[model samples]
Target: MTNWLLRASAAGLYFFSAFSFAADDSHEQFKQAERIAWSGNYEAFQQAVAGLDHPLKPYVEMAFYKRHPRLRYETEIDHFLTIYEHTPLEWPVRDSWLSYLKRHNKKARFINYYRDTSDAELKCTYLTYQLDLGALKKPILEQVADLWTVGKSQPKACDRLFSMWSKAGYRTPELVWQRVTNAAQRGQTSLLDYLAKLLPKKEAYLAELYQEVRRDPSSAAGLYRFKQRSAKESEIAVYGVRRLIWRDPELALKAWQKMQAMFTFSKQQKDSVAYRFALALASKGHEEARFWLNKVPHERQDAKLLQWLMSNMLKEQDWEGIAVLFTGRDNLSHGQKYWLAYSYAKRGELDKANTLWREVAVERDYYGFLAAARVGVPIALNSEPLQVPQTLLNKVSQAPGFKRAKALYELERYTDARREWNYLTNTSSDDEKLAASVLAAELDWYDSTIFTLAQIGAWDYVDLRFPMAFKDLFIRYSERNRVDLAWSIAIARRESSFAPDARSSADAYGLMQLLPSTAAYVNNRNKVSKKRLFQPATNIRLGTNYLEYLKRKNEGNEILATASYNAGYHRIKRWLPDEAMPAELWIELIPYTETRDYVKNVMAYRQVYHTKLGRDGNILAAVLDMKIAK
Candidate 1:
């Protein structure tokens, strides 16, 4: 590696106490060769590293081929790519080779080697090559149509192919109108204007008006303009009303009532409007929700709508409504089952409720654990170990792809490292994938390990799936904060899968995913400080303190505290029931899907962590004893 790569890699490795590179002359030689490689002296770069045997030698080859414009040495480049096929090393060489083939008009080989990609230019090139070779077919034309009809402008390379496709009558005014609508939906007003010019005068007018409706959905409230009530005009009305409902449900409802008189909406269009209006009313607790929800036909009641209906009923304390909503549904999630059981129990039907609870208690999850507590049975983890022998693990770990991935990760080329890791997980054998997950866990790449296992549905390997990452720090901070150690650890695990430098889109950092502002507040409040929020120790300490604060803020109710931790405490306060309600019912009624799922996963993971740490594992029993109240 070059000095920059070496220094960067060293800095990354410094974070892990268990990892260290050997201080040897071979390292110096590699660095010297890498410097030459980057300096554009390919011959000297090769000579410098000729005698070396290193895990990162492929990187030097990659540097050369990536910069080499021509594919003069195809065999050598092919060998390198084949050896590092799924590794990050394949990226530059493959791209270079593909570019060379396109430039040279190597149509057959380009088509042969071409994998599907999202790059419009590359796709255009590929299709143009196919057109040149007389491989035109319906599917090919369909692909060309798809490419041309996208909302945004395609690359200049696509112009020739699009012109040919248009000459062949594949480009219709209908497709242009579709593109106009697509552009409007994507907020590409310029593209919409460009597309509208391709349509007839009347169609262009409709297209422009649709764009106007997109810009301001309430513009459709001028029902006089839609007196034509054409299918296209009705489509614009339906589209406008659906969006308007979310912004102002009462007005949308009034407009929708008027629209039914002016427009002839198809069954699908009416159902779409009803779906949107019903969900909007139910979500906003509008007085008209029950009416709108009932307007939706039974066959049109999808899972999401049913869930919202149940939630609306629960908020109204209509247990009979909830019971009715779940009737005839064959597939109920454990959470759904728990709520259904609660509904039945509230309606004085203990037999049906217990039966459903027993069914749910047989599984493992937040609902399963809580149902188990209700039914007086042991929560079933069904924890089964993946039976990969050490020999298989050793063999798979020795693969060159895994080595390159590890090397890239250690060098802190996170994007490239993730690409290589994802390739392995996606393409490997069942045994190999499981073994690689085990290796990933051993390498302390907990995020990759956790997700890889999930990708392969390998939930049975609880030990590998849930490693005790940063346990010492967790214990220290949890004790200091007087929080449950397992709960704290579980929170970290759910937040980031123990990735010490994890960051969320919300700008929460480190294993515990604390916002920097929150971390600073906790630091100032505690008279302690850490400049780096990404550091595992500082994040854990601050996160545990925040958890303790949430617990206290919620009056020592862990369930509410957990919910408050995911959602804000103020939101949790608003979500609290007016009268005391069962914990299951309250959790079911949490409006935000993210916080609802977050609370459930944290609770379930905490229970598992308790058993893993040899601590008391009855967190759910205490949770069941508690009630949610104002």
Candidate 2:
């Protein structure tokens, strides 16, 4: 027999021969190998893992040593690579090996094994490696040019490579201009300033001209400041027109009329500027915006233009206008097609509505459920349970990358931890992917656990899908405020995905995603003392009280209460109509993309939670029963 089989057989026999161990079998013994490895029992781990006939053997071996900070030698990592070349552990081990070499200044060793063609940081390291060997010239300069042309600043690891390029006089005016143009399109003013300093004194005037247009588009509204015209001037005119429209669309229209008579802009530039103004005004629900939008040739119209045009029509209840927007479009999304059908229904065209609804009702989602309700069809989840192999489960449980992922989560570096967890899922077998998902849940990686299962198409595990994390707190606060317990669970699932430590860039915190100001008001009203708003019990209490207040304001419509919870109550009130309309249509027409989707997702989660809790009847039926408050 080969060496590997001998080791496997030896491992299988070790437990039986060694002692009267507490575990039942080899699988159970291998489970403890991971704990022993993390407990800093490297030698003991090796001994135990050797007596284990499981796929976790190699993973447990590498995981213990990867977390230790003192193992810096190149030869030591090289030994690891040799043993695990073709195994499932190769990528993580190799990635960490490269990181160790880079962090410790082992340049020669990094170059020897480095071939990461995709990561820009490692590519800069490649240039540094070539510079060290004195084999630099044309190729190195080409890479420097590529890196410097990006619209945003390159990562700081490129500092050395960029300095070398500057010393060699390869940084040219042409390359700087490209980067400036890219930065201008992206509104990256800081990057534009940095690139401007690299320009020659004569060409530096161009950057100042671009800045003037950016700062105040009204100055060039009539194009009366210039005696001459060039391509640069034409581009500046386009930008100025867009800015003028943003500040005052009515005045922008007047300026556009005068500029057309006074200046000659290329057809492409004129179309570009007109579309920008039209789309902006349409977003704000300007009455005359579509008159300008219709002037753009049908061939030039795109998805964004169509969406904003539809939004304006929906706000006006001009069903014919909505139909006209999609008449010639061939690339309509499922959502768009569903909305088109709804428009036809409002126009009393039942045949067309039925045809469209039939196509959309087969999938599972907010729209699909609504479509199903409209056409009297059952919602189709079409999800299947995953069958994981026992061996792959062992690999997932003991991989070094997973250990790193868990450690990062503990530190509250959620983004970094997500990337590490991704390494564990990237190439895992289907069953192993499910096992990784369970591992995430076990670690209370709420978002990762939920999203990972969705990632792998394993959607039937409702318990995993709708986790009962912090149920006691949800029940306590929800009942105290008379908020439906299911609504509280639904809000938490959508807001933070049951992550107690979740936070948004807006400083919204915890299970309910309450902003500090909102949390403070809730606390003051309840006479509770100030504490961490992200703490589970406190956040739930504040959030539920906020929900109760909204429900009272909206006449007990959970749909409007939920929408108010995401968007402020005042905004939801402003969105209310003079006449009653179906609540689903009201949600579909809401302008803010984030708030619209927030309402849809939370309501959908409400359905899932209700179904999982053994409630019967159509969930969307109750949601649609809501009427717009007059």
Candidate 3:
């Protein structure tokens, strides 16, 4: 046994040495292939990759895949597709190519390729495309449905199924009604009724459906029908009155009293009842709408209901009510905290505002920053530079009017902060500019202040006082960073479209939407007095510098960097890792629907700027298309 063990160990060592040498050789070969591929030599690229094996082959193939549709080397599409479909390349590349095929109406090819594609997201996308392209019918629908139904409880699958069916125009009211009923059985009656109305001809059958369901009330279908019928004002009143009286006597009394006072109660009466009931309860300080809400039946809380409630809450400044609704709900992303904090602050509840701000600040939330700035509370800036939260940055950067300018200033991106201030001052009436002069003087930006005053050629727009100073230094600094000039101009365009003095609830200050901390950072870096950050040049320079930093940090991954510019680098980085290749690919794969759209816009903007400047239009494209370093 001892002798056998020794022999085995020796053989294992020899095999390991051989494997290591082979791996080294394969890696060298892969690099050679990559070099040839990059040079546009498709034949050599193909030959080099073919000579490789296993893991090395996959990477080499990926490199070639990325540079497909070679202008010079016209490889047969079939060969490319065959290799992509059968090879062990990464999913992102495979999925990208498959999507490309689908886009070009390569239906037969897509169908064949999709059969071998196992990635669920890719498969769903392909199937959805098939349905969209009109190549799919009921038979295909059934197959997709069966696959989805295997895990019906999973929300993603259900959503995909719904999306697929909806896109196919399969208006199965019965199925919608059935789902609604099922939801009701699980105490999700509200969800059930919401889905019920989505069915075509639902209103015509609603009454009969409700009567039948109410009589039986055994299945989800029955409950859905009952809720659909009960969604009416008269029905809701009857149900609400009973439920409120039993579950919440106070709210019931309020609803009953409001309903009884209505002179004409018909189809419109029900809408009025719902509206008035909510108003009356709110007026009576019945903060919790639980009792009356329960009486509303499931189906009535559709998109319409949700919109109505949210709209009212916003318009009426019902902070307490909104707080009740959103509290402990994961459905509300951190983005919602700003509005919540604003509502609380409006009510003069400092403690609540501070608490919520703290919660928001922890996540570097965008709205939270505005809320904090609005409330005039001191928020500790995260020490790490260029790591501010994206949500806050995006909100501030996108803020409209003078409020946007203010947000930039408050965030301490003095250069941009001041540009917005100057814009407001320049565009404002003489009296308004005069009021703002003191603000400019405080930041030591007298030149911007004076120039703005001079530019009020015919002050036609409303303006306010600028109390911060530092204008001269700001302009000087701005000249130092041409990129800031471009960025400031771009930001101005994006925010109020250079309307200057643009204001928004986001509290973004100036042209560049610099947060207070960012402005301060610029102030410190330039050795300009901190007070001067609000000067137009200072704000512009700082804002531009920050934007440039983002561009550099993402290695010219403009989309990621732009989102970082608008949102924040930390937030964008959080979506991906520090790895070069995956990071670039992941930026293209960002899931945040907003950021994804933002990247395209920013890249398009960059390209436009490149063209405007008479530089190569493809320069930015080359920057974007560069291979991620390993």
Candidate 4:
């Protein structure tokens, strides 16, 4: 009996194992079928689906059919309609479906579905469809009534509906005005009377609205009312006088003095009025602006006015006054601190400048470099060798604006750099590959650039930008012009980092940072439209032409021309009369440190690019032969 029971148990275990294996096989088949469907192998996917039985068959079929192309108009329309009917659509996809439906002339169908559906999004979509169909006025009126009915039960939806109604040009409705009055009572006045027209019968609402306006005169609606009234009216005159007190204090005093007999006020009100009186006196060059500002209650003091006072102090180089403002509760932003540091540096307070620089450098914020550079301090973190943080390096590599290959090179991760360079050189234009080749040569890696360039057939992408497009163009241009290609590369790198859309603070645009006026002149001379100057080929053409023009103007002095390109030709020409100096010395002696540093950095970068091209030594020889000073 025991042997028979054991046999029975073993038999059951075997059966269970077999069933589990079969289930596993089915799951694997489903996964493979899904893969096939995703790859658009419809025939294989359909066969896989057919092989599935019962419940799995429907599931697999649905998955496969969801991806099927809707070639026929009926199929496309029916597919979306069915999906919309059955599924709760997400915002992004629902928006797409709505657009598709509208484009296909199914607006009525969409509106019907939207109204019947209980979903908030659906109702919103319906209202939008109604608006789009130019049947907004009726629906907007209905929505206002719905808001009153529902009250706070669906405030968000009501708000959205009200905003839509306002946007659709129904803001002047009596119902809307009533709703605005209600909203204002509840302190939700932001939307009230926004673009609302004033009704002729204003006496009923004016007193309440005026009180709210007095509480916050900065409100646009209040300002509009004050402007609309005649100057002789006491209330209008008082409101306008108060506005002018802050904005144009001198005018406010004149208006207030003229209306002295119009009204009586309490002692507190009279004292509260003293602040503006002092401001007006100060505006007329009286020292009382400071006197009143000091006497004003701390709680009542205007932060904006204080900030303005600090700004004026800074403009006057009042270091002690700036320090006083800095010590206030409102700590300055990094940018503000940087400005302060600049002021300190100009005052010859190196210790203070260094302290500010240290604070900025440690933050590793976007403005750190600019701040540190302004203070003549090298941006360092904890006395450590400046290494790009791995997180930052990874982020920069993935950034669309930065060239990954160049960024990798900068990070000194050479193997990965070579891989990216290989990819860019292999798949892009000849000029680009040539540039890659130059980079490879600098790393002592040969043939990769040539092979990649050839593989990509880089010449097909070339236009007037020539060398700017390809590494080979640089070599050719350099040889033809008898100038160092390395130097040109350096300048280009500093100007744009090779981004075609690079723009400067001075309104210089494109890869070479050409000023709009300069670009316009170049475009006109070339008979190219002003708009075309932003295009890569056009910008490069004009940029190089301008560069060449500057080179010639500076008597073939590359350094001087490069400086003139950055700091303006007129400024450089005016400064050149001091003495004929080597380019390096001239760069070092440049009055504007920005231009001076620009020349040095460009020269240094030229050598770096040359080294990357495996022509570093050769380029150095060529640069030396020019006998260029400084």
Per-model TM against the reference: 0.88, 0.75, 0.26, 0.37
User: Across residues 163-266, which tens digit of lDDT does each residue of candidate 3 receive?
Assistant: 66668866465455555444433444444455546646545354334333333332212122333333342443444344344345465665556555542356
Error of 1 at 129 (Å): 5.4
C-alpha displacement of 570 in model 2, angstroms? 2.9
Q: Which lDDT tens digits does candidate 4 get at residues 357-433?
A: 66774433324544544444543222111122333333323322224344344444445455555554444445444
lDDT for model 3 comes to 0.48
What is the Cα-based lDDT of residue 423 in candidate 4?
50
- Which scores better on lDDT, 2 or 3? 2
Q: Model 1 lDDT vs. the true structure?
A: 0.80
Candidate 2: residue pairs that collide: 388-431
Sort order, lDDT high to low = 1, 2, 4, 3
Clashes of each: 0, 1, 65, 17
lDDT of each: 0.80, 0.73, 0.48, 0.50
**True-vs-predicted CA distance for residue 492, candidate 3, Å:** 3.8
Model 2 alpha-carbon miss at residue 531, Å: 8.5
- Ranking 2 against 3 by TM-score, winner: 2
- lDDT (10s digit) by residue, model 1, range 161-280: 888888888988788878877887777877777777888876777767888898898888878777467877888889899999989777787898899998778899988888888888
